[model samples]
Target: MSNKIPYVNILQSAICIPVSDEVPIALDIKILPDKNIPAESFFGVWLLDVSGSMGGDRLENAKESLIEQIGILPDGTIFNLITFESKVNEIIKDVKITNKSRQEIIKKIQGITERGTTSLYTALEKSLEILRKYSRTNGSLAIRKIILISDGEPTDVHVRSGEENDPNYQKYFMLAKEALEYKSSIDTVGALGEHNVYLMYEIAKLSTGKYIFAENEEELKTKMIIATEQTARIAFSSPTLAVTSITGDIELEDAAQYKPTVIRMPFEKINKRESKAYLRSFEAGDTYQILVKGKIFIDKNNIQTETNVKVLELDFDFGKDGLRETKEIFITFSSDSSKFKLNQDINRKYANVFSQAEEIADCTIRGDAAATQKIQGDETKKID
Candidate 1:
């Protein structure tokens, strides 16, 4: 019998990070051949503090970031929103990421009044409960986590700010522990230089997640972007296929999720190397197909003049696995030929993401909820 070598479909994971307002980075996270992800699915929890302290542009920026965050989410992310202050509110009770519901949710967010004392602990408790309602054990996806945005500590009488005053602190600690124990990432986004940044950091550490401090509205935008990128790295940076080529078509789509084609990835991390691979910027109209995406420019006009532009490209024979485990990949914007040439052997420079998918493939995607997987052994048992 002639031996046959089946063309193994080594699946890849993609993650899109929408920073507060910086360059949007979508990374192709590499994983081994064993872990294959399907087309599109996203799962996450958003826990925000709407206390009076988080008013004005701070709240506005948070909403903006939420839109960006939600915009890139694939149809699969069974996301739920938790906002808190004196009390906690669930904006969208475990809803899938969609245009209509997300718009309605954003409108609800717009009506959020920043009133009442900050109740960080209470918020955490209640939000955790809301998330629990959507937990994997309860039939939610496995690749899930929490995003906590706040600028203060809990005002709950039970918990102490420090180890010094009280037994109630232990209870609060347990509450935090329980939430994290359930395998959910807890990323913290705090106001830049706010006195409560320390608390945010502490919470991040407790949750084994990312801590991001945004100093201003602009930085908040950037931080939001960074936060999303970081999440992408963590969730999707696992791929086996190495990209032999990359090109950017200079395109601008409004923050709205509807009218544009999207790249969906599960998770992405920032501080780590090899996790940063993104589609570069190029205008399809400015340059034709063969030369549309391979060069870098300080200015758009440079394209016509064809000045000193940076060129990076990838040409690899990664065998069956497509991508290797290397920590870096170079960028290649389709070039115009006649003018500029390639520069220093540059690798896709990876950077820090202080802070952090779509669709319905209908199959088991990577990080999917095991609770949804049944049919195990000799006997019959239910999944979840």
Candidate 2:
């Protein structure tokens, strides 16, 4: 029997109709993972900012947090460390961090102190090179990632006066774009310092990775751990949802890809008034429902295996609001047009509820405030 679980799970709301003129209705859908397997070998590359701005407690706290992260990693994980001043410095190449070299790794981490200007582009370039080499030689058995922690803006150490043309704003994005070719990612951690927040965000976004911002040293520690843990859980392959069937002329609006071939579910689509009227025309005193169809695709053969290492075990959430294995979107149609008014308050409220839910999820991911109270309330209810 295969040990692998379903790669992606479907989660969606089932609409209940008291009455509708039409037998089926349109519904929104979301794709979520049921469980994720940890990679057999994780290739971690740390891009640290050792500039003048990161001097004193800021730098010290960063080093300490990084040390804690190192202490918790499982054996046989290959990693590299790169620190940036005015230039990029590689403390280690792609080395499998074992007990013998762990001490040496610690020493190198401690030796890094604040010095020159921050050259983020150079560091990222070096990081990507390491990932490419590893992928070619070691094969596709590792979850390769670059962890970037920076406190200041990108500076050109050689550009004394005017903006230096070569490795400017475009350089950062170019490096991110290059990493994608090798299936490598760059997860950026933004700390307290003067820098372009959007730059850090774009670096993560373009690489199909994560971006976390810390307001203080304490938060930085928490965020770093979160990033590392997530990096380790990189899925073997991205799953695509194949729409099996549709009952209505519902639009699939827009979709945003979260990972390779992984589309976040319940994408927004504008429903035309005509589509609404067709369903609303159903006679009163009758109830109807629509079924949307899809299945998650997982390529198990591409999943890599390691010698002597047991796969990391993780659990799946099957709660109603938790991760679901499959989705059944029930669009209820009622004969009482007044009770289930298509254009009136009933349908409007239904759309508003789902719209707000999607917005809340977006804000939470961005760490911004948008109906924060409602989000907290929903979360609290889930916990209880």
Residue 370, candidate 1: C-alpha displacement in angstroms: 39
Ten consecutive residues with minimal summed lDDT in candidate 1?
A: 375-384
Residues 237-341 of candidate 2 have per-residue lDDT tens digits of: 222232322333333322332212111233222232111110000111112122222222222242222211111111222211333233333333333445442
Question: Total clashing residue pairs per candidate?
Answer: 57, 14
List runs of model 1 lying over 4 Å from the truth: 1-40, 157-169, 236-384
Q: Which stretches of candidate 2 lie over 4 Å from their true place?
A: 1-40, 138-140, 157-170, 235-384
In the range 16-83, model 1's lDDT, one tens digit per residue, is 11111122222222221222223344356787777888888887888788777676666656767778
- The top-ranked prediction according to TM-score is 2
Task: Choose the strongest candidate by lDDT.
Answer: 2
